[model samples]
Target: MTVALAISGLQKTYANGFRALKGIDLEVRQGDFFALLGPNGAGKSTVIRILCSLTAKTAGSVRIFGADIDRNFPLAKSFIGVAPQEFNASLFETPMQVVLNQAGYYGIRRPVAAARAEEDFARLGLWDKRNEQCRTLSGGMKRRLMIARALVHRPRILILDEPTAGLDVELRRLMWRFMTDINRRGTTLILTTHYLEEAESLCRSIAIIHRGELVVNTATRELLGRVDLETLVLELAAPLDQLPPSRFRLRRVDATTLEVDVRRETLLNAVFAELEQSAIRVIGMRNKTSRLESLFMGLVQGNEDSTRAAAAALSAAAGD
Candidate 1:
């Protein structure tokens, strides 16, 4: 497969001496829905900004469609579309006009821009509101408008930063379906969202970044399989002040429930055997598969643990 986006040794540092992005390398394959996961301030946005030319990278190289961003800015940028986290459309502009103007920025002719804008608005369920001022639209409508504007130019790569942030369940699902259709028709997508489940479902691969560094990048299935723990919540009919001594570890969540993190290999029978041995009645039981949320928390918190240790060492040295 062709490489749609590539970054090598990417680094970004602000004038305040805060390093926002450490040396990082990533590749987004053509026609793939690639999700980037990280906590706030994890440099996910930094990478997206650099790729979209919204911000300059302090160091490193980026190529879009094999065209170097720094060397061939126009060619590199032309193949990419960005729906930023912030809304930037003119409040007075109608939805149709907003998208049409975006197309014009890419040098698309007026007639073609108008036609494409109408088509996109209809497809995105914004056709009825085409002539309404952007400010008059609801939050979800505005978000859909942003997506329609991005699609105006028909870029090969779409970078959506928290695209479904405040959308309702139904609207969010609609957008997901639209995005999947776009991907199937050959658009490469790079998504950064707090909705980990959305990424887990939509992305073929994922890259997790933390504190300016790339921690893990692999296929979604592979990443999930690598994190071998699954959570089981057992609700007992009666309250238990303490847990029975058993081989399986358990954490009390409430008066009647206990949460257990069990390894996938031994989870099923071990849990049942332990419950049987203790004569604990399982009134209700729920199992949750390890997902991107757990995986991300593990990586981000794991990094924080190391950083805390290093800080403690530095503090001790200063005391001496």
Candidate 2:
């Protein structure tokens, strides 16, 4: 597969002597829905800025679809459309004007830009709001407008930084659907977001940076599988004063709720059988956290030593 984006030995240091990125290396394949994730101040945004040419790298190479940023910056940048974390559209301009001007930046003709703008606006549910001043639009509307602007130029790769931030659940799902369709239509997507579930559901592959260091990069499913433990939250049918004994690690969340840690080797039926023997009836059950979210918490909480090894092992196994 062709690499849609590539970074090698990437380093960045602020003027104040703060290292923002440390020898980072990553790649996203063409047509891939890839997630670049990290906690705040973990260099996720730094990496994106470097790719979008908004920030200069201290040392290292970045390539967009084989075009080196240093050797052919315009070509590299031409292939990228970025919806930044912050709303950057001219608040004084109408949505149509904002999108059209973005297209103009890419040298798209006015007629072509207008057609694309209309299409993108309709798809993002902003067609009616296109004539409204951006400053008058709601936060979610502005977010969608940014996405519409990003699409107007028809770039090969789209980099979304917290695209769904501040969006309600319904709007977020709508945006997810739109983004998923974009990827399905062959647009490579690189997403950075605080919402782990967004990445877990949408990304085919993921890379995590922690404190300026690349810690985990692997297929999302493979990453989740590495989690040896899962917490099952069970709501009991009846409240109990005392806990029931079981071989599985269990903790009481409340008189009517229980949290049990189940290992990969353990089966749900076995857990149910044990609970039955203890006369604990579970009225409802769900995972305490998404598998990917659980793994993310562990990795970002200074437990990345083992995970870095796992990422290396996966990379080697894939012959990367």
Best by TM-score: 2
RMSD to the true structure for each prediction, in A, is 5.8, 3.4
Q: What TM-score against the true fold does each predicted structure earn?
A: 0.85, 0.87
lDDT of 2 by residue, 177-291 (tens): 9999999999999898766777778899988777888766888887767655678999999998888777888899899999998877889999999889998999999988644
Residue 27, model 2: lDDT of 88
> What value does the lDDT take at residue 297 in candidate 2?
71
Summarize candidate 1's per-residue lDDT along 89-207 as a digit string, tens digits.
99999998898788878999989989988888888899899999888999888888888888888999999988888888999899899899889999999998756778889899888
- Predicted structure 1: lDDT: 0.83
- CA error at residue 274 for candidate 1, angstroms: 5.0
Local distance difference test values of all predictions, in order: 0.83, 0.85
Instruction: Return model 1's CA RMSD, one decimal.
Output: 5.8
Q: What is the lDDT of residue 169 in candidate 2?
A: 88
